[model samples]
Target: MEYPLAAANACLNAITTVALIGGRVAIARGNREAHKRWMLSAVCLSGVFLVCYVMHHAQHGSVKFIGPDGARGIYFLILAPHIVLAASLVVLVPKLLWHSFRGNFDAHRRTASWTWPIWMIVSVSGVIVYVMNYLLWR
Candidate 1:
């Protein structure tokens, strides 16, 4: 049976967003270990999501957006940035993890300072895209 991959991808995006928030909170509270665990989980989930997303789209091709004029424009506005940052995270996230694993806290922190917000926005906007495309707009 074919899986509902788009919905699944959206769920994964939500999970990654939660993990990102948790990691941020963990570090803010001085819980390095928790931060590491949560961030790593976010990275792993995102990796899986990317694979599933690529496969689904490979099989199914693009799913066009259908909505009212204003909403459609807004969707593209959110989607544009989300796509850009999601691509950036493909590199930034792994680099951020590598720095942390290598005990380069200073570098890690510097990169993460930028990575966190972008990642959060991408993850959240991903879900918004899914909702706009598959749920609300559909």
Candidate 2:
């Protein structure tokens, strides 16, 4: 059976969120190795999510937001930023990872400080969009 791609994407987003939080906590505790592991896992999960997301959209086209006017505005409010960051991550994430892997801690930290919140927002708002478009409004 064909699974619901939106739901699958949401699950990936949640997984990425948990990994991101874990990575952040690891770093905050000064556990560099643990932070690296968790953040790498997040990157891998997000990479998978991107592939699936693109495939789903390619196959199914856009899933329109359907709801009351107020809800529609709210949905776009969340979606617009999510989309912009999501696109930015295609470059930002790889650059962040490269800095980490190259032992450039200062550069890594600098970029990660910016990348983290944006990534969190994109991951979380993805689930919010899924819920609003698929579950709540369905």
lDDT for model 2 comes to: 0.91
Which 10-residue span in candidate 1 carries the lowest summed lDDT?
1-10
- The residue-by-residue lDDT of candidate 1 on 14-127, one tens digit each, is 999999999999999999999989998999999899999998899889888878888988999999999999999989988997998899999999999999999999999999
TM-score of each: 0.95, 0.96
Q: TM-score of predicted model 1?
A: 0.95
Q: Residue-wise lDDT of candidate 2 within 78-127, one digit each (tens)?
A: 99999999999999999998998899989999999999999999999999
Query: Whole-model Cα lDDT per candidate?
Result: 0.92, 0.91
- Which segments of candidate 2 are over 4 A away from where they belong? 1-3
